[model samples]
Target chain A: MDRGKISKWLKYPEKMGHKYSLWAIYFATGCGIMEIPPVLTSRWDAERFGVLPAATPRQANLFLITGYVSVKTLRPIVRTYELMREPKYTVGFGSCPINGGMYWDSYNTIKRVDKYIPIDGWIAGCMPRPESIFIAVTKLWMMIDKGAATGYIRYRENYRYYRENQERILGKLDWPPLYPEKMGEDNG
Target chain B: MDERELELFFGPQHMGMVGNFSITLKVRGDRVVEARANPGYLHRGFAKMMEYRVWIQNFPLVCRINVMDPDPYELIYAMGVEELAGIEVPERAKYIRTIVMELSRLASHLAWIWAYGNALGFDTIGQWSMGDRDYIIDLLEFLTGGRIYHIYIWPGGVRRDLPDGFEEKTLKILDTLEGHLPEYDDVFFNNRLFVTRARGVAKITKEEAIELGATGQVLRATGVKMDIRKLEPYAAYPYLDFEIPVREDGDSYSRMMLIREEMDQSISIIRQCFKKMPKGPVYHRVPNPFKWKVPKGETYVRMESARGELGLYMVSTGEDKPYRVHFRPPSLPHGILILEKLLKGASIADVGHIMMSLYIAAPEVDR
Candidate 1:
């Protein structure tokens, strides 16, 4: 959060014509979690884009599952999606969350997270370049600004398995520290 | 003294681990009595993956085995297939390959620097080092559209030639980096606080390091002048002039210093390769990836990676895909015996420090 970068970002909102403030982004699943740093940093600066990753479900409306989501992680992803208030959005990065790109055949990884949750935007690539991620962010911002039906609200209608099998999916294998925890947990 | 000592598991899920791997340590109070390195946490079956894909297809996948420094995998696999096919890469491509490889070395060293600095509670240096590494990654992306896994180095040569003004751009970046090195030195290298924490933390004699099969920085840290770059000149290394960096401290501080020195050497190597680079085709057309079949032969190529000596041994059964491919990762020695010994008498907080100093990359260990 350098002062120079912050000032530049401050000017981008009015120039880009965005309406949302205090937008919250989430990384519930995938290798895209690796990109969370730069994605949140001043360059990509999700905040300046008017979308900040919220620390809690009570504060967020956007869930950006940037990479792959294994079955073990799907439960948490589903839970996080459900906890967010209405008018929520979801963006999937890389082919992983959409169709399990390289690990499609793996028994552990889910083929299409979309099948489980509604997706607002899809950035395609084995692992989408950071630039593509940026594009996806802009697309997501436009969709949100328009007040369109982006992410799903009915958890029972979609991701029934995720809702039903929470313990089995999320509880298995003691998720690594790198795995995102429920909001308020110290990630470090 | 009573019956025994305290035991602690360093990871598979522990914060101390470099990636997903872990180690179990047995300690008598602060002094370690026994230690064992345990791997295989995030093993994606890389060996089996190689068996399923064609020789060319395996290039990208193989690089993941050592994500920190992937160019060696590119060079190793390329050298093996080139040997099998009896093909000689163009002179210019060879120099280009060396330049890219050395740049990869610099990137890898930067990553280690970041992790090591963070491990010692020096978070600012880690951030600074990582931000600097982004510049190298940007340059790599410019050269070969791919950043992390540059599958550009194929069987015969690179996928494409240096882009327009690639040399000038690279030289400019190098100059910028040269200017920044003094600042980095003031913060991490010459900083008194870092020196105290890292000094005498993990030590091994030259004989012990050799006996334990240490290589690269760990081996060099033990006063061994063994570097794959010096012993085996792959690509255009024969034409380049560089020295293998060695240190006598045999401790974590020395290992850290070794990488710092190595970064300078890598910069020098890249500069030499750029100057001596001849003009010619950047790539020699190889048989189509779909129709390619290597001659029945076995070849082993080793490269001095940021982690250590990464060796790729390929056995071709006269098929499009390799019959057998074995990766001898340096993490094995560093991860196992050397790391196990280093943990002795150190606090649990220093677990990550010991691992970083030894340069035990997890994928390399699992692969």
Candidate 2:
């Protein structure tokens, strides 16, 4: 509202920019996708938090994996996660993504998403309320501020371990590497 | 000729598309020669998963089958169980079930409106529809605990009676929504630009619609009057009266018009339920849910969801768990078969619009 605000932004535009403008990809993997309409629209208005839906993974910094992740969907989830650039953040919405919620024993769905891809934060509910989504986004800003959201770093350092776990379930992966190869190991 | 045709995957992660489903389009220039819908991106193996859970446990799980309209699944499951178990629902509970079910329909149609606008690049209408849809969600929140998945409509009867002054609050919300309808008509529904863009964009003939197994708004928009509510009345619909909105054009515009009018009808149906509602307990006492078992029998029950005819077939061998379960969701024809047929010979620009207009939700297709 004032020049002071503009001056503060001018000094640390990168930090403020990353904090203020978090664009989540409009990708939904589960039933929790229903909560997204109210959050993004005029109802709960998640845009007031400077959050909006990006059309693709390449353009987005914030990723929300809503609800349960089935074995079939996990491949695309990993691909979508890899598509995001550095300084990216991920928020696993609903209890399904955290520990599979009611679908814990489901033959197809993944019990916990963290085993494959690192999750920065989790909102636990069968379907979290629209207001709770905004609170999660606010908390995400705090994580970004403190630099505690190192999911990307973790993904890089432990790519081998994550890839092995993924390969065990999704045998004989067809796609090529997301990150460049190392010298010692086979590219496969 | 085949060499000229390029294949592209219109992915699920797209903003203009509905749910986690994709379509592989074979296009030459800008016109699609063939289309194949790729589902299973959102499949949680719903029918397969349901067999493992006991009857009561399956109630909450079935709502996830169609996120946009969860009640009809719950209704069908409840009805199927009621049929097999020979549970007679109370009169007043039927009325309450009717009201809540129609409210779910209204909420879903609002969602359809948002999807249509989003597919056609009308952001303002999408926002307006979603914002308006929240009023119904708020009412649902007051009545049921959950906003998205109510799980309120259960076997034997509903989960709870109407809340204190709920009828008055519903009337107020309906009136407020009714007042805003004219403004909506001016901005998006009746706007010349929107009409011209959507009219005759994706046409489905009446004969083809029926042959292709199309129902709900898809068939209704094509001048066919086939509704499960009128044909086989369930819950309190037999006591209540409502008209099915139909348009003969069988195009995207007609479907949009029909959905808009249906919202008004849903409001009316809810009103009628309230007016004719007799005061009584909402739910009938039944055996313990965990221990509840049906006599060895097979039963099929159907209901009219926001999408269309939703049916559930349950088989029991005198056991608490279902021996077999199958869902006849409208999305199968509406999403995969009808979508592939409709996308042929259409411009790439109209692909998303046509799909959304058909109300092809991915979960229903995959499930």
Candidate 3:
């Protein structure tokens, strides 16, 4: 009916091609394969935005750095970021990604997700409201349209400051204590 | 033909996951051959951190363990130390604690509703649930400055006295929420799709659940009728009367229903607490936050959290800091061992759903 409508119809088939980007996501960086449902669901779906996971360093344009990252997780996070193609964007879902919202000072939780990966958006809640998540996606979309999606470059340039000397933003988080049973190895 | 297994790790950042945890799945064709949970992402060395901060500082810190229902942590720790130090909580302080605790319960269960809906791929349910949950958080923020982590309940008593007309405002909010319950049921709790997806999934018998260390809804869902509040009434719970909802089937569906019904019970408790609350000083006169030293003693206090029985084992050395603070988090048995066992033959899609229903707090587990 209109030029924009014609363009939308033309892009629909091409957009469908992005669903396969999930496998590329797996091949690109294997963070948590189990958490792929929300990443692939009908709503909050990653494929519709053309910002899907890439299999290798060359195929990826955007990195959906969803969920929390810790020291144990920091290794894969760093490796995956390193493997992504240039001019990529990183989005941290929930407060776990930024300032370790719920898990602040645990030996394992990285105080700030921005320590390892360059975050384009930091959703405030512990597990962010999906509306905030959708807002983040829109922000990322705007960044893409503006051709300024490379948070990785800025991260690399300021790497030393964020990595070595950044003050832990939310210091000494106030939370309930979680203590594992002492490792006695005395099971008979 | 090949002995070498292809290892596929899921989560620690994946979308289908409940939180920051990984599942190493060995998949042969479409079925999972073996699965193991790797949880350490949100670990913040809670016990170690507790050892560093003073007793009062730990009140705000402990609430972070399980962000959903934080009132229990503050209440239990304060009560435990108060018992050890022999401090008498004022009558008004006790009633205020009960009001706050029940409000925390309402918010916690509401958040659980969002997670449950999201897990089953029902996004609208999640949206509605979260919007409704925000009302509870709003009410909480009105009482306490912070939304998710309300560092309100302190040793001796609450942090501040009830704001002018706080009870009236809270009751009004509860009235609004009561009207919205049937709509939530239509969309989530009794939704046919959710009912189908959750029914019979992870079915455990009562005896099996007891042996598995299942507490809270997991125990109640199996028709166990076990609740820590009833068994050990700490803080102001001894004064409040409430019913523990139980279900015959211990499946994921039954557990979801049990939690939903529990929210109603929590609301009722809040209403009762408000009706009977006496007006007086909100906080008892305790030593200041920074330089306070607790008597040397070990107190094991357990409270019913949104998940289950959360036991805080505080070992004090009569110093400004705790000698050792060990948390017997309810989520561990369910999130780790219980989840691994139940997920053995289930589809990979249902993993996050089951975990959400279990309501694992990554910080709680890691601490």
Candidate 4:
């Protein structure tokens, strides 16, 4: 019971909507996806925490980067991340996403996930238990309350910097830019 | 006649498709005209990676091949190694492996039900099936330390013996699952809407199904009585008595029905394992991981996984690490050939429904 969030909840119902109804776009990457069914099912019951899988990225605010991101997968990942609405949060769900985990030396997989996507939190394990996902979600709620979970905002503010880094690896990205820096107009 | 052709990139991210893979669908109006599969998004090239790791280190890597049903991949890989090394799994270890495999089959079927129901816009059954699958995953967590990837089945035998009072707990979970069958029948299996949507949606002939290299439930549903468990007995399958559920409809409904009945069969098999299990050592220690070198030989071991026949082809050249490791996933033909052919005349609404009904675990395709 953080007093700040409690007070803010009363003041801003908008924040309450973001806190309670966090729709996660299940942008599955690798093996860690096995844990999601159990989490969403009756046993783990992630719905109890108001987290559900959104079919499309446009409707979701929480992007769950489930496992290792290979060089090829980062293209869709960035596109999906950009499609997500503002006040968004991203969580890297397994050890693979945090630091490439077992695939550290694998030529295709990216060793550091944070370099490309602005991840608000990480659940570290070869594959973290379903319960650990709940913990990450609660921490995300706290960050949202404090207005600290600003990965989306950060993505918008420094689109050029992030875009350059993304383009460094993924040359001539297929999709149009999420925010055009050349227009000199703040999309944020 | 007025319908226009639309080139749709039914890529990896869509709800209907399985895993991190894509399908390039050419559709005119609601029906698909031509389809091409774009796979390997989840491809870490695990086979090449296996060559670099030692025999024991590769055990965990095999499970990553099929995310939905990792047990059979681990089992087949272990069986391949066991055959290549001339290692014998003990009686108790074989029984334990059988029990774990059957439990995995149950969980995998439940997941298939969840996917199928969700694909057909029946979220109620999806939630229910997922709830039931969790019960099986809980038992898995109890047996192996890990929930998703057990990595328990190794060359010589299993990792360890069953934990204390594991049998009794397993019985209770089975009882609970048995109780939930009627509710599933009402909401999903026997539900009129599901039957209407699934039946005749993606029908395949028996000859083409076999010709196209489809196996497991997909092949079985096409009226072909082919099951690796029945035809080729491995592990404790010879001792255990279970019937393979086959349906002749060769449509989405038949496949769905076989999956439901197979879950019941898996449950029955687990009960049989519990009744017939014997007490003995679960493992026979091999030489140190680094020093253990398999004899020079090539072996092909195939096991019936949740989807179908999961085969592993291993080439060991008297080396500490395998020279070549190849996986024959049941989902390959089901995903690419069967799925693409099945999708050609299927309405756009049935794209995901038909694919889910086929039960192609996409990770296996890429791996």
Candidate 5:
């Protein structure tokens, strides 16, 4: 622990704790996952920033949607995102997740991942460098400090719209609605 | 009397999985009775997508088809376009292309080692290999702008010549990797636990390998002695002197050993490329990307990628875009066909081990 931010540690210990230990789901969404091995291992060493790969979504709080989300993968993404506990933050890792990057007109890939699921931040590049991952993590820390990284909250508030967006691309999802009470209005 | 079977879905989210690809296994007790490969999670319709993009624009897109090893896709695409348009690559570019492809093969094999290690529950090898892979990635970044997707190999030749001191840096990295091989063997390959676990698991006979379209290490491990570089030479492979390492066991251990041996071959190939590279223009400029129209013809070009034989069949019809583009990635057979066959009687514990030994890159299968 750094002595420089003693007051910060005292005032909001919980937020500070969440800020550091961001366990990301080891989910390889697309080509962007190519950079992940280097980031996690001895080269870039993301563990220095307290970011480590979680085996499952339940164990992870930080979800880095690594690359383009094809329609086939969207269902699993939604399921994984829903499985994570509250205060989970999602960072769209490449240009593809923002607006499809090079695969803009791909027939099977969804253009905006945010339309299906809320993203707290975006790392812009065809495939962002491993160093960019560190930058994104630091930026996420700032967002968390300010209480602005609330994509999970936003997701709950607007679950209907996100579901609608997902249903538009993928036909009726196999699983039940995550928030059943919120689904009382339009049961479709 | 009747027997009950458990339906186990093992991927798309499992830690033991290769990537987005999944397999549905019907298991009785600890042994798998039947296995069905489920792909398309990473599909962006690459072959169809390539048809819509202009000839020059597809260079960047092709490499994304295989995330583990991308340079071969670039080389095959370039070869396809060059053959269609009758463009001759400069002699220097040929050597440079060879060096880049072999370097990519080295990097990909290292990545495979990491995956294989991880699959076998040996996290130590995974850490070491992944860290070692970064050095090669650094070399690639120095030569090309991008680390993962190096859109360097174009129709006529490479995008640019080697940067100053690139040769020296490459040789130094090669020396470092060569020195570390023995340590890798001691920790992972030759370890008693690894040998016992991998020895007879998912063994493939020579006939099964050939019949099922297994290529690269899968085919080579079966004592068949088939290599695209040796059989159908490409780039500067015709000039380089390297042996194709073959093992008779056709087991998981044999495949792993073949990968280790191939890394040595790749290093040697790169060294030969640097020694024999002629000094000249690295690229012969193609016509403007927006206005260029290739002649009406279809050409099929294949090369030995790190995984296996990667082939691309491209057709141009006097338009700015290609009429048809099809890629035969090695993972298709290894991941879907061979995997399903091999998993029939394998224990649940060896699912990941067998998959890694076959070296299935999920993106290649889905793409």
Candidate 6:
């Protein structure tokens, strides 16, 4: 709606569309989910920022992993990531996913979430406030505008490394690889 | 024609499911023939981790056990450690703890209303209740410096005393919440759609509820007058006079109504705490955290959490760390045993509805 950004919007129409409407799939992994309702509801009203909760992963572009990812949950996290359509964004919402937060010492939780799945941004706090989500969203817009937020592209390029890291913890994921086993190859 | 049965997996991902929990259902047509709860997705192994941390260090770790209602875990842990160390909480601290716990209950019940409303296809009610719940979260943030994880209550006493004008702010928020109750009734509780959806669904008898270890609103809704606050009084509960609201019908509607009425009771209890609190220090300083050693003893402490009877059984072996720490979260029974039983013969659509009515926090079941 800003008159000044009209020229910029006209120049990069597809980028502007993706930047504005971010349908989020909030994967409630831990304690950080407590802040999500407030952010989505009337208090913070994430709709104003064009961030809304999508019903399913296939429908969503923004994947907000909203807490600590335990060993058991990591498989589902990986699966959900694979299921989402390309040009997707993933934001680790709390301190847990960044570096395991308080569950760093615990045996079950994975330390660094980036080892398993690519993260576009991280809003770091024990439990980040609802306002922090908005800040993350705006920052994501900037990243998308600059062509910097290419986590989906990164995942595709380095699928083997990410898959190997996931297998190290999860022990042989039941599903096959999203991309080919080898890069730049026709498997047929 | 032969009968056919199909296996269905309900969430850790589905929209209707609660948190990172799933249930395997055997369905014949729309009706569930058998249900099995699959928890442990949220388990951080708190019981195992507590063995490594010192007495005071465990305080912060315990609250994350139940995310929706964290205060009761704090209260129970503090009570367990206080019992083991034989530390007496000040009279003022007792009153403050009571007020904080009740406010937590109100916040949790409001959240339940939000979830319940949403599960039952009442998005308007969900938005209204969640918006209102933020005011209570703000008050908690002001008191404890954290919204979700308060980490306020400890072994000796609370982390801090009530700030100036705190009581007035709390009362004003309570007034606002109380005023909205009637509107909630109009849109949510008294609405014909809610009644039609909730009534006679997941109905349980008084004997069935008692037999299956169903506590909190589940038992109360079944006409059993059992409240840990009343039955085994803790903190300032003995001094305060509040009724345990009960209902004859053990259906989902009755359970929902019990939660609504208990919010009223929580408000009254908080008001009474403000009136009766005496002037004194909030905390009695304990020994140094690093060198502090609790005498060899084991104690079981239980309290009325927002969900149900949250009990902690702690064993100290004259060491800085606990020998073993066990939390008897009410959700363990409600989510697994009671939930599985209720799901049987239930329509596939009402699975989330019944689960929410039972107030099953998945973390509590696994933690």
Best by DockQ: 5
If both were scored by DockQ, which would come out higher, candidate 5 or candidate 6? 5
Q: Taking the tens digit of each residue's C-alpha lDDT, what string does model 1 give over A1-188? A: 56775564566654233335535544324435444544554345556566665656667776777666656456556656766766666778777777777665555666777766778778887546667766766666566445553456433333334332454544542433222333234322
**Tens-digit per-residue lDDT, B120-168, candidate 2:** 7788988988998999988998999888888998888998888899999
Docking band of candidate 6: medium
Q: Score the docking of each candidate (DockQ).
A: 0.11, 0.72, 0.17, 0.59, 0.79, 0.71
Q: Across residues A95-178, which tens digit of lDDT does each residue of candidate 6 receive?
A: 999998888899999889999999999999878888899999999999999999999998988888888788888898788788
Better of 1 and 5 by DockQ: 5
Question: Per-model i-RMS in Å?
Answer: 5.1, 1.3, 7.2, 1.6, 1.0, 1.1
For candidate 4 chain A, which ten residues in a row score worst on lDDT?
A: A179-188
Better of 1 and 4 by DockQ: 4
- TM-score for each candidate, following the candidate numbering: 0.78, 0.96, 0.77, 0.95, 0.97, 0.98
- TM-score, ranked from best to worst: 6, 5, 2, 4, 1, 3
Instruction: Please give, for residues B245-307, the per-residue lDDT of candidate 3 as tens digits.
Output: 999988998888887888788888888887887878777688776787888888888887777
Clashing pairs in 2: none
> Where in model 5 is the C-alpha error above 4 Å?
A4-7, A185-188, B1-3
Report the lDDT of model 5 for residue A36: 90
Number of the candidate with higher DockQ, 4 or 5:
5
lDDT of candidate 3 over A97-141, digit per residue (tens):
667654565566666777656777665654454456456666765
lDDT of 6: 0.90
What tens digits encode model 6's per-residue C-alpha lDDT throughout B39-150? 8899899999999999889888888888889999999999998999999999999999998898888889988898898888888888888988999989999999998889
